[model samples]
Target: MLNYLGLPIAASEHAGEIDHMISLVHWLMLLMFVGWGLFFIYVLFRFRKGANPRADYVGAKGKLSKGTEIAIVVAEVVLLVGYAIPAWARRVQQFPAESEATVVRVIAEQFAWNIHYPGADGRFGRTDINRVSSENPIGLDRTDPDAKDDLTTINQLTLPVDRPVLVHLSSKDVIHSFGLFEMRVKQDAVPGLDMPVWFIPNRIGDYEIACSQLCGLGHYRMRGFINVKSEADYRAFLAEEAKFLTQ
Candidate 1:
């Protein structure tokens, strides 16, 4: 269903549910279109001038039209309450445990994404706006012991396959959207708000991250990459980053 629907390759385990929801909505729309089109055609032929030269004083009325209208309303209500709301609730409200999932902070700026890892200590180092510089965009307090072990990368995110990854998303300036098509994850990165998105990538590959919202003049360049790797490769990446941090 996914491949034939023109959707991107969904690498995340939970993406199938998203695709199902999309399919359901499209099917509903198609059904409505066909039903209405046929009704219009029938009306044009039934009320043709040749059949009735003089217009009837009373308009044609029947239970079928009322029933169709009621049915459409019921279907819409069911779709909203039973399907769409539940799907959104699961994505936003039902978050996985931080201890069980790999967590990272994704900070957005104009035309760039800053990826911050908590290192071995599993703690984000202190950041100060006053210390902000061209080289230190996040303004990490390097004097702090925790800051010494923290790892930061530019537009690069790495995670292990078969495990949930929680991304704490925020922005420094205006609002930006973080969209990963394959994982079916899209969330707004608003300034002064730390939103979270969790997903489990079942396949090992690189996926594109696009900003669905137009934030600035360079919004087209606001892109990132997610690299889902095997467990061994994930560990190796950690080890290599740790060495770089220590040096």
Candidate 2:
């Protein structure tokens, strides 16, 4: 059903659940559309001018109409309370521990994404606005002890499959939306605010990170990539980035 609906492949842990809700919503809409269309046809045929010359002021009334209305309301309530709220709560309130998850910071700017990874020490380096430049987009204070092994990349985010990935998202300029369609994750990256988004990638593949918001003239070009690899390959990627730190 999801494929028929033109949805992308579900790659994350919660992507299936998200797609299920979407399917349910669409099913409900289809039911309503068919039911209403039949009702309209019935009304037109049952009350034609030729059949009933006299005008009837009081509209038709029946248990079927009332029952249908109640059923529709109940379906909507079930979707909201049973599926939407719980799914939303799990995404927002329940977060895996940092020690058990792969954590990274994604800073959004005009036409680019800066991905920062805490190196061997597992501690993020200090950043300052004054130190920001073309060479250092995230303003990493390498003089700080924790900053010594920090690694930064432009438009590239790599993570290990089958583990929770926690991304601390922020915007440098205008608001941008971090959209991973395959993972069914979309969050607004607002300036001066740190938004945390987490998901577990179960598929080992490459996915595109799109800026869903119309942020600026270059918004169309503000795209990134997420590479989900095995645990060993993921560590190797970090090691390769670390080697560049010394250079």
Candidate 3:
């Protein structure tokens, strides 16, 4: 159904549910437009000057218009309570356990994305703002034992397909939005806040990540890529990155 509407490809497990909700809302909106428009045209023709030369002081009394308004209100109520609420609850409240999922941290800045991996030990290293510089974007404490194996990358995210992945998202200077359309995942990266987004990529491919928020003069160039690879390939990529770490 989404393909017919020219929507983006569904690359993750949650894409189908999001597409379904969007289709429902659009279909209802279209139905309302065509249905109410025809009715309005009919009313205008029925009360034209040729039909009623003398105008009535009081408006014509009828229950049809009132009933139509009531129906619209009920439809919106059902869409909110039935569809929107459940979808949000399922995504935010039903996150998988960190131990059972591959965890990564995405730190957004003015014009780039910083991807951090906890390496083999599964523990993030310490980061300090005072140490931030052109060479060290995230200010990693290489002396810290936990940070010795941590890997950092710019503008690229690599994950294994068919596994639950959690991203701890944040921004360095201003607000940014991490938008992965194919995965149907979008979350704001706010400064001083750790927001989490989880997803399972079912397809192995490369997808684009756009900054949905306008940060500054360089917002237009804030682009990233997500590489969904097979489990073996993902492990190989991790090993390769680990070897390149300066620590």
Number of the top-ranking candidate, with TM-score as the measure: 2
lDDT tens readout by residue for model 3, 89-171: 98999999999899999999999999999989999999999888888899888888999999999999999999999999999
What are the models' TM-scores?
Answer: 0.93, 0.96, 0.94
In angstroms, the error of model 3 at 71 is: 2.6
Q: What is the lDDT of residue 111 in candidate 1?
A: 79
Ten residues in a row with the worst lDDT in model 3? 1-10
Instruction: Write candidate 2's Cα lDDT for 1-247 as tens digits.
Output: 2354799878899998999999999999999999999989998999999999998998658898789889999999999999999999999999999999999999999989999998889999999999999999999999999999999999999999999999999999989999999889999999999999999999999999999999999999999999999999999999998898888
lDDT for 163 (candidate 1): 95
lDDT of 1 by residue, 1-247 (tens): 2464899988998888888888888988999999989989998999999999998988657898788889989988988898889888888787999998999999989978889898888988998989877788888898888888888888889999999899999998999999999998888999999998898999899988999899989999999999999999999999998897667
Task: Name every residue pair that clashes in candidate 1.
Answer: none
Candidate 3 regions exceeding 4 Å error are 57-63
Q: Of the pair 1 and 3, which is ahead by TM-score?
A: 3
Clashing pairs in 3: none
Q: Which prediction has the highest lDDT against the true structure?
A: 2
Off by over 4 Å in 2: 1-4
